[model samples]
Target chain A: MKKLSRNQTFMLITIPVLVLFFVFNTLPLIKGFMYSFTNFKGFGSYDMVGIRNYTDLFTDARVGKSYLFTFKFAVLATIVTNVIGLLLALGLNGKIRAKSALRGIYFVPRILGGLVVGYIFGYIFTYILPALGLGSSMLSSTKTAWIAIVIVAAWQAIAQTTLIYISGLQTVPADVYEAGAIDGATGWIQFKELTFPLIIPFFSINLVLSMKDFLMVFDQIMALTKGGPAQSTESISYLIYQNGITGGQFGFQSANAVIFFIVIVAISVFQLNFTSKKEEQL
Target chain B: MNKKNKVAATTNWPVTILLILGCLTVIFPLYMALVIALKKPSEMTNDIAGALSLPKSWSLENFSEAMRVTDFWHSLGYSIMITVVTVVLAILIHSLAGYAIGRCMAKSKFYKFSYLYIVSGMFVPFAILMMPLVKQTAQMGIDNWFGVILCYLVFYMPMNIMLYTGYLKNIPIALEEAATIDGATTWSTYWKVIFPIMKPMHATVAVLTALGTWNDVMTPLVIMSGTGANTLPLAQLTFQTQFGTNYNLAFASYLLALIPILIFYLVCQKQIINGVVNGAVK
Candidate 1:
């Protein structure tokens, strides 16, 4: 058999994958953009509405509330998970017995499905916590419902972030700590001066990943609260999913989704730029 | 080295204490789930302290009942099938494409541009595509298991491709050149030479894809809803309402869903952690 040319080989390899990608990935994106400008209700013929959905998004209360809740949840969850994860990573990285076993235990939550974790915690918040006199169901109130979501989200999310931080921590050479110890710097001071600066890249990665992931929080909200009590914990992804796909607000939700897409991109890019600059300074 | 030895010899009591506490927090929920799932509903007193106690009988009744109510085996079958197929296909197809693009992009602008085009999908959130995708899949008569698998493949493509391509960079072209000099065709060279060499990356992609597919709720919920078919996560959500007051059954079902991934994690904890860190850092 004759050997194929480089371009021929490349085309042979990529054509099928690219076609499938375009059909499943790119087409929906393009269609979503087009539908955002229309009055399509996910079925039947519809006329283009010419920015009506986008305009309505500006004045929409539920949309605004969902965005607020999502951002608030993302920020809180990011901080909570990163702090806890970093601390846990620090502990795990220390000289310890059965270190791998401990690391495996901490990572359990990362492997479980989000919906399952949410449901387990849903029962906890509703029954166990209240029974423990923590308070009446955290999922029952608008004010505190988001807190439950954050706790559950962080519980699962911290697993990976902690692992990432541990990886980051391992990259710090023991000699640096030795140098600090010789200078009489103790634990906290050594960490602050020697360890922290070296791990900024990992910290930034965790921050950006956690932020992006939590921004699109959906499964946990569904299993825990279903965007209740009174849509208080409804994330942007949940809103788009529940309202757009199931509620026949296809075009409207597509508009929201497009904006959501832009916001995520902007935030990711901004965070990357911000963190990269900080990394350089260090 | 003396300082390091002294630090290591002390056992780091504070860090050890922190790790133990963190371990407690991590293990607490799983223990609660297990305890709750093993008990009868009648044994679950309204008081939290009572619920925290070990089950009096330690029966698998709730597990059996949960299996009946949730159609647990059916959903488990679907989850396994979907995850297996998606992981297998993702590894094979993405590796091939990655090999082509990773190898040829330097010499071919088209391949480089294609690489960018494909990877740019990474930035587009699934939210933007959810509604249109539902319509597209429905119109294509594939809004079922096949469609769900296809979505997973495409959804995971950008990241998998990126990872594979990056991994391929470390593999010397001399191997492929040697194969060619031995009169191996492109296909033969890829399969005989490149494929085996990419095992580590294949494992990374498989593990990541399997975890994502098995744990995903949103995609299956969007595509497979109303079709009477359910992945494990979707099945859990579907029965959430029915499991309303039956906390034991709910916990039992949650435990049932958790078992497979839990086992997978146990077997591959180190690789999973390294794969996640590799994916994140790259």
Candidate 2:
């Protein structure tokens, strides 16, 4: 048999994967992009409405609210998770008893389904907290509902972030700390000058990831608030899922989705560029 | 040396106390879930303090009832099948594509373009594709398990391919060159040599994909909602309304959905943590 050329071999290996991606990934994106401009209601009998959907997004109160809520939730959740995760990682990395066991316990939340965790926390907010005389259920009020979501999000998310920080902490050689100690650097100063610079990459990784993940938050809202208390906690993704397909607002929500896509892409590019630049300076 | 030891000893108490508190917060929801799940509805009191106490007669009745109501076995099977199939296929196809791209991108323009095109999918939010994908899958008559699996393959492609390609970089090219010199075809070389060499990456990909697939609710909810099919997470959502105020049944069902993942995490937490860190940092 003739030996396959390198190009032939490459094509042979990659073509299948490429086709799969096109059919399931790229084609839908293109189709969605096209559908966004038209009045396609996710089924038969549709007319092209040009840029009406895009224009409507600006005027639509619900769309505006969803965007606002999503951004707020994402930023708050990212900050909360990262701060708690870093603190926990610092604590876990110390000379604590059952360090590995504690690490494992902290990570338990990461493995459970988001939907399940949401439900469990939903119960806690709805019944347990109220029963404990913590006032009314947080889920019952729009003001505090998002806080509940953020808490649950932080609880599940901190596990992985802490693990990442721990790994980052481990990468900081003990000699660095010993040197700092010799220089009479206290814990806070050592952390500020030595530890922080070394783990900036991991911190940035956690930041970008946490931001991205929280921006697309859906399952938790579904299981907990169902985007309720008058849809105050509705995220961009949840809005797309709830109103776009099910509510027969496909074209309109497709427009929302396109904008959502752009926002995510922009944030990711910005974060990556920003973090890489910071890393270089460090 | 004396100062360093004193500093360490002084800090230990605060760090340990903080970690203990963190551990409690992490375990709080799970503990509540377990306690509530084993109780009968009649045994549950109006007060949160009473809810915190162990059941008067720790019963598995809630589990049995939740199983019957949710058709637990069926959804469990679907979840298992979906996760296993997606993980297996993701590793195989992704690694192959990764190998081709990882090896050839520098020297070949098309391969380079393909690599960028595929990896760029990571930034596009799934919300953008959700509507069109639903329509696309329905049109192709694959709005079921096959479609869900196909979506998972593509959904994971960007990250998985990136991971595999990065892992592939550490593999020496001389090994493949030697295989070629020994009368080995690209196919045989890949299957016999490159594939085995990629086992560690394959494990990482498998764990990540399995966890994602198993825990995901959105994909199945969109693709298979009305088809009398459900993954565990989807099933939990569908029956959530029915569970209503029945915290016992709801918690039991949540625990049921959580158990498999919990077991997997407990057994391979170290690997899971390392795999997640590897995925994130790269």
Candidate 3:
């Protein structure tokens, strides 16, 4: 009955997990990087043309459009979801009647599969809205279709984001608000001075999270628009799906995906540094 | 004192009104889905503003039709199986690794290395893994439910590990020490003492992971692309596409796909909301 050392016990538990991650995540990532430089058709090997796929990706107008659209969607989704989520959290965290029920109602969509929500909204845009004499269907236009996509993403995303904000709001000491009131600070002043600063951490979490999620937005786009209106609404992730899965340009999309990965990692690092610095000053 | 009361009363009404209006907008699309899902097919043939109004005759026929068209029960079963297996297995493994890092290896280099490794997965968008992962899975002869589940485990490991590690860090070491003094083995102590304390975090992780695995489309889309394997989301997407003109059946299938999750959410809304908050604000 020899007792294992602390590090031995830890390694015993974590080794299998580490192996699974290595095989399933990191190894494939390295392979994906390697494949980007080759002409591999997903399976059978081909010549390694160094950086040709990267050069091709840089010149591809459609891929560039998809990147632009994904960025636009992610930025807008982050802002809208955070603002609305914060507002909901503020209102519902107070002494509202049936607060629990309202929160439940608001969160219903969050639990739903994005495909379902997209299909429901797709029906609304293509059929119901037109039937209501709302002029032309929004999906027929590039601009309005993107707005619809953002709206659906926000509707579902706000549920979890609001809950995060509520948690953040709960952390603010009651006495802080009470003290603000004594000094005649109330309404917007109280929120701007006290609430906003405290919830900034939650704001960053929701921002980066929703931003990342929105950048990879796939299910809803697949169900709703399928990147319609002449492929104007295609997101980067969806484009990768299209190119890699359907188009069978695995090597080329691999190049696009590697670039996407680098951009995301850079953004996340920059965001964390920027927000943590602000959090400190606050 | 009089002025303060007046201000409070006036401000409360506007905020309340604003919240109500916002909630209505949020709920409008869901309400529309319900309306369409309930309407009789015959009654839907020539309706305009009827899309906005309540159904004249409600029936369960559309649901039955949807079920028939999409093999709804089979897909539902598949979705449940995948979600349950992925979430339960992923949680078990992630918590083990998280606990090892949190408790036994806190000061070890392995802890820092594993933590950084797991967190790095969060920033690497799934796009990067799509092409090569597919090839890797094919080479490994794992393009089935097992492969999809494994993919989910790898993809979700980072966040799940983060949640469990953060949770385990807070659990007092005194409890484990007492168990050791009572002659409990390490595994026994974890199962009896530490595991019980982790129930709240377990609930949080379970709800979050369950919802994510159930709603995901991309993983299954790639893994099961040519396999004809359909989860509920995939079923809905394909059904909608095949029957693009059939709004009644499409909406009904959408409802069928969402109903299970919607019910689960209603049952566990409180836990899920708290879970999201706890998972984030750490």
lDDT of each: 0.90, 0.90, 0.83
TM-score of each: 0.97, 0.98, 0.95
TM-score of 3: 0.95
Cα lDDT of model 2 overall? 0.90
> Which model scores highest in TM-score?
2
lDDT for each residue of candidate 1 in B1-282, tens digit (9 for 90 to 100): 576667676667767766777788889889999999999989987787667899998799999999999999999999999999999999899999999899888988888988999998988999998998888889999999999999999999999999999998999889999988888788889999999999988888988898899999999988988689888889998998899888889899999999988888878887888777788887
Model 2, B1-282: lDDT tens per residue?
Answer: 786667675547767767777788878888999999999888887877667889889799999999999999999999999999999999888998999999999998988999999999999898998888888888899999989999999999999999988998999989988998998888788999999988888888988888889999899999988799889999988998899889899989999999988888878887788788788887
Model 2 misplaced regions, further than 4 Å: B6-11
Of 2 and 3, which scores higher on lDDT? 2
Model 2 achieves a DockQ score of 0.74
Off by over 4 Å in 1: A1-3, B1-8
Q: Chain B TM per candidate, please? A: 0.97, 0.96, 0.92
Q: Any runs in candidate 3 off by more than 4 Å, and if so which? A: A1-7, A43-45, B1-11, B45-47
Scored by DockQ, the top model is 2
Residue A149 CA displacement from its true place in model 3, Å: 1.0
lDDT of 2 at B248: 90
> Higher-DockQ candidate among 2 and 3?
2
